[model samples]
Target: MATRPASDTQVLAGRPFPLGAHPEAGGVRFAVTSAVADAVEVCLIADDGSERRIELTERTFGVWHGLVPGVTPGQRYGYRVHGPYDPSRGLRCNPAKLLVDPYAYRVTGRLTNLHAAQGFVGDPARGPASTVDSLGSVPLSVVMSPGGPDTGAKPEVPFEESVIYEVHVKGFTEQHPFIPEALRGTYLGLAHPVSIEHLARLGVTTVELMPVHAFADEPSLIRAGRHNYWGYSPLGYFAPHPRYASEPGREVEEFRTMVAALHAANIEVIVDVVFNHTCEGGPDGPTLSLRGLDAPAYYLHTKRGHMADITGCGNTLDAGSPTVVRLVTDSLRYWTQELGVDGFRFDLASTLGRPRGGMFDRDSTMLTAITTDPVLSGCKLIAEPWDATGEGYRVGDFGAQWAEWNGRYRDTVRDFWRGVTGVRDLAFRLSGSSDLYDHNLRRPWQSVNFVTAHDGFTLRDLVSYNDKHNEDNGEDNRDGTNDNRSWNHGVEGETEDAAVLALRTRQARNLLATLLLSTGTPMLTAGDEMWRTQGGNNNAYCLDDETSWLDWTPSAASEPMLAFTRRLVRIRAESPALRQPEFFEGRTTVTGKPDLVWFRPDGEEFDEADWFDEDRRSLCLWIDGSNSQARNREGALVTDHSWLLVLHAGDEPLDVVLPSREYGETYKPTLDTSTADGTPAHPGVLEPKGRITVEARSLLLLRAPRDIVEGPQTP
Candidate 1:
């Protein structure tokens, strides 16, 4: 050990109110929370790889605090928590393994030697503590400037008007030819004029970026020369992934600039956060930040000290513990205030509500803390709403404050287009799933509806492949989910058959139109609009090459698909009846017409029996947009145009009639998914009771003339 620092001058007692290392006027104030450690040493590392260890003598509550007089900003450091290494009690504090600061705003270095960072010597689950020093193997924390969170202005878009785009930071900009070579795959690349222009044109109000938090690839993958491309394994919450930054040692500024640019484009930034678990796998895994500091308080464990892996990620963070709750809440607040992000999408969110005993609770301590938080409560909160275990899947159980990724909507919509489901479940999904989210004062927007997300197949692949092709994942092609409800039109993978290709394009259009026109917030996956494909690899989470990156120069179908997607977005922006604030009741609206009425192909209202008929695949929705129940953001009443949406899933085309005079006076065709383009080249203007032929496996949207027309809206 290095010589002890002079307690009088070199080390001074510091406050422990805010954890993490913060550079002050003279030096840096270091504070870390650890309940089971006997002592904590702040190890400062020089450029030459030499470390000077200073023991923090003052202990307040569960936090250790000390101030070093000569510490400056950007100085590299870490902690060596000294305590018992008893695995039976779930305590694994080893001074040999240099632990990362839980609240580290920035972390540097790479994890090269997995075993060197492990705490145990023999059988990792139960063995003597290792004497090997991890200072040369693991990453170290860096001191950041002292400040409150960033107060940059946010778009603050309402859920009713938000169209979220889920994109990976690297994959989004990697293949863009217009972006400069140096800025490609960096934070500045996403914020560049070209990137912003694409998002603006797509009409996405918010960009829900996949994990940009500092992460580490699994040791098994590292040894195999593969990486966790999606970045689900988080190493540091506060630190933005340094790989995305264009300038070295300036990742914070670069991330802030990216947020500022997106906000300027009227788009909100929502980061996908992984607070349910850490990079540390299990008792047999390596000793990272939380695992090495105080495993009992940070992780949920069995009585024998083995991790209770509810997330199927080797270990589940104990959300029930106050220490863990504080860490999560503080991290959220820090990201919100300091980083200028508008919201968060919690990954495996069910684990956050499972306080104790591995059962999910809506009123868990963790949920309450975030809801009651002054800064975080106002920010948009989206939940994945599921975990790895069967009992952890708690969809539609989150409160009104949260919007969930509606897995049912995704499954039902896919099934409807694939001819596997009847119109009853499809109707419930299309009209804002009241059966699942009607309670808790939840509005229609609480369901963050999505047909294709980051975890599943892209929209292009969803129609081109009936099964997953994950052979390159090195998991024997058994890694991705087998429950993909997809259709290949006729042939699998890639083909030059024009008939099959045309049908595939139509199917893709049907899915996208359903998602955007549904009565909830819609999330579009990146590169879906450009007809990007992974060659049917539904689980391309490991292959980070061309298999994952968005190819701007994609198929010839790219132009039409991208144009159709933008048209759908514009149509949703112009029609409020399509994205209603309240559930449709089939009652009279302000126009003295039914708020929403389901009709048969013969222009008759759907009876109870028609809904459950398995053969019924065609349905027409007459939505009265004279919305008396809706109030704008300024608390003013707003009325939009009524719409007649016709959907047909059968193979043969059918003749459909418009509703009588009671529903509308005249209708103009706004969109037709059957056409090569989204709109018909020669549309026929007609009155009520007029007849038209609806093509198979297609959707048509006809708008009722609005006396008070609203212009095209953003997001």
Candidate 2:
């Protein structure tokens, strides 16, 4: 419903301030920063596909500016700048191609393939019917309307106080029966009260939406009618994918509304951003915005113009270059300053850390700018930590300001639960991977722990598949990792065997327990609590159908998992001990006992043999709960309290000796995971026995009387 500006406009010398686009007295002032361009033309395309090119006369600070008097919000436009075609010095400007406004708040055009628009070396016959090199000159304008500019809303939830739920926007609610058919798989569907209420009930503070930006369906997948369901191949950074919005050109407003709605419910939004590379592949790939505009500058290249393939995508973005950094920084600022998003989860974050030598530099200018930038200071910044490049698999290497997806936590927890158990691995992760994160004085929360995410198998599928069933992904089964380390519980995929189902559900609970109980910040994949599965398709980055959606109606197992998750979150929120910002010291300041004491079922400290023995599956953990930074959520300090956690890595039952609590307190049986009904096995106190039997592949938590101890004392 946006209107176009008048045909003829004066070339008024616009102010060069406010770099990208902003509201002016008459309409919207358009500006783009490019030091090399001889001239920049803003092309306004009408509904009838007619174009009016307006030259921006005012230029300053490597920026071209012009005020279009009548161009209102939602107007479709693009730019074409005249510049040198020399590729050797990293300049390849093709004025024939219509370029996307790097700052455009909303996009209105439909993506169509054109053969000439691709690199000349590729098979020209593989493109769409219209073989013209130019993608119709249309300027996608950025403007301010009734709402004025964005409010730069920030939820400002700290890592310790945050619980992330990673989900796909479309797959999350696509098959949700409560959501209307038309709205399903759209932003509106995700924003529905049912969706928000469910997340709220689960007590997750943030929703890490997987790639809501405009993305392309890989050509091979398109031929097979399957697509990139995760939307990692970004087509536009500033604009939300049009399909997620209710209608074309409404994506901005829709996304803003979704943020607002979630904010009202006290949940923040974190986008899974893929700036490591673009949809435009290698030398023979499609010529999208950056590639068509200036190939070498925007993308990393070899001496002979071949694309650098660090990202495992056909090409890697030249984050080392200023223009590429500017684009990334500008896009980040736009999402925070203009679109009002809470934060971003960088996909393959190593790409952003890439320096000239293809090595990671913590002091990289881009990382420095983003962490210190005023606009992004209050927003959450998380990284996936590793990429396909292999050089930059920096888990704890990122500076202290950022939180990293603890991939080690994921792998270890999976391996332990799948019967490859060990006590050392469990102890390290439970105390928040001190070996990985503590070297730089970083807190436990710096490690964002999770058992599964959108990129891998769901909690259900993890216990149900030994290998990836990604055949439907059109990449054969070879697309996903072969090192899943998952177990199928003696039955692959779905099963009618009630015993196997029971085992899988228990494993799911064990995984969830491990994730939440870990000292680091916990992140749960959305629908994991409800036992959602992608049919064992670990790499469901493609497949937007029911495979990714959250089935609202939970089965018996899903219901139990959901309730358990809610209870676990409540327990975590109520107890300050579980959410420490600092690393746990082995010895307590108030008491002489180790703050975290490890024990074998034989009530003895772990030996070197125990640490290395792969068979060392059964172990007990004693946390000096009195060392909790503060009281519970009710502000009541349960003084001198202690808890012993027993973890049996396999399906064998073993006796766990409860370590004596400080100050003569007695042990109270709080929860046991072996029950098939998902409820506590014993409501009353167990006989004050030194040893308790714990089932295999189960977790047991025992609470000590709070009043017995006045200060820490050696057991």
Candidate 3:
């Protein structure tokens, strides 16, 4: 390799103490672990563009290390190492290519044009498929300043106590009335007092911001002049996407400010982290970060040197490698320790558990490390426990420390409200899908209940569209999921009929009631309370237009949805019976009756056959408030303020029975979704079973006698 001026100023001071680049007592120490490199060179470039080279004199345990005394922060540097060019052995080190600091906190330059973006495709000039060495065309690495102290403290709320509101940073407050026009789509907007106040009002304990890390537009979208609105394609893990951060501070600093502000408001900040793969993509993709750093080391690959395409993004990360695992762990720690993020909701977390035989390892090193790491121990770790890979769906398999996004809950609730008979599927969902997650002593909160999330249709769209309409997404409407399990409510798309609109509105209420009122840690997709929509696009991941933004000026149909959501949340907060941490034990310890009573419209206890009957829709669940798993602030066991939840499916009203509480408490009407304020219009004494009319596609909450207790009723 020729010694260019870019490689000629600083001498390599080999120090093998810290693995990756780190700030030592005096200056930064850069180290990279490579098992086969014959020699490692550190090229330091000065501010004036002068460069010096130093060959590392030492190699310890396959790790090349160097500590430059005067190499301060912001110093431009790159590494050149001599190793075999055997592709079969997975060694592709080319001394001519300047490699990036695997642990760089910040980068200063652009891709030395697009060729540098090729990363290590052999030769980009020959295309990504060529086998020739493409070292000269890739970009060089630069040293970055170290992150300062952590900006905020963790809110430290328990998983059961958390009310996560997932939002797209750009879409969330962009159309809000109070946010400034300039700051509407940026991080500052999320941390703005107006945004915080709204969360406070909604009783949100955490804000799960979707993909704030730097990301790139998918090539297909870029070709169509569209962009990935969901921001799942991560380009930089350490830096917040500059576009989301508006002014003076760097991406990390801007993110810290947002977290600090949220913490100040007593709300925690959770980031949706995409670590399954990088924006570099598949064989025909960009090679900006990991691919350029060390393709085989940073990514999972077949024996043929081809990257494994499991994440559906072109490649899957090699979590089995120690270096790769360290990279992921370090990135997580950096976000939690330096950026003050309260937690992470891992995107496609199953990829992180990939073991030796391509099967997911429940006890993978990365999973164990995270669950045991002190810094991350207190942080809320959520997992979207599946991926496109065949063996990657481990939904209920994650251990006690991890909370999973219960896709089953979402599907079951949607199906039940859509009147897809045999609600027995819903029985498990309403109780946290214990069949999937009950092996451990995990509570119901372990199932993070959600009806609709960012990846799919909004609450409004779910009941308004039977199919996705993503024509504007520039993919010929072929990009999104075909099976949305949604209903168009007597019409396929938008409708003018008042009755149809009313049904759609009521159906949205049903979904919300099922989610918020069910036992679990509920997560509301932001703007669902106001019935946000993506036109009819179920997958708006690539649409940056009005299709993706949350328009605060809601439609007429949205008002009722919003009111219903507020009422549902308030009721959940008011009733300890609804938010019980543990699963119902069936028999009540106090009354000796079932802790939960399921009834049909005829006031009969649900039979084994009724549960399996797919055509049976309407059902009532009577909750014994005295059996609540919570206590007041004084720590006394909560007493029965009994509540009856009546649910009806289909398009006609039905008379449902409210079973009498074993304590002889009477039923009083409290909240009715069929009404405006969500308050019931009438109250009546409890018979052996009291009957109430339930509107089609509606959920009603009926309270029991509050204070007056009844003496034992004679049979």
**Index of the highest-TM-score prediction:** 1
- The order by descending lDDT is 1, 2, 3
Candidate 1, residues 128-240, lDDT tens digits: the string is 99988888889889888855324367888878889999999999999899999888888899999999999999999999999989998888788898888999999999998
The global Cα lDDT (0 to 1) of model 2 is: 0.74
How close to the true structure is residue 343 of candidate 2, measured as C-alpha lDDT?
90
- In order of listing, the candidates' clash counts read 4, 9, 9
lDDT of 2 by residue, 643-680 (tens): 67777876678887655444225777766677753466
Off by over 4 Å in 2: 1-9, 86-91, 119-133, 136-155, 589-591, 630-640, 661-664, 687-689, 707-715
Top-scoring candidate (lDDT): 1
Q: What TM-score does model 2 achieve against the real structure?
A: 0.91
Clashing pairs in 1: 149-337, 149-338, 150-337, 150-338
Name the better of 1 and 2 by lDDT.
1
lDDT of 3 at 213: 70
Estimated TM-score for each candidate: 0.97, 0.91, 0.90
Model 1 lowest lDDT segment of ten: 706-715
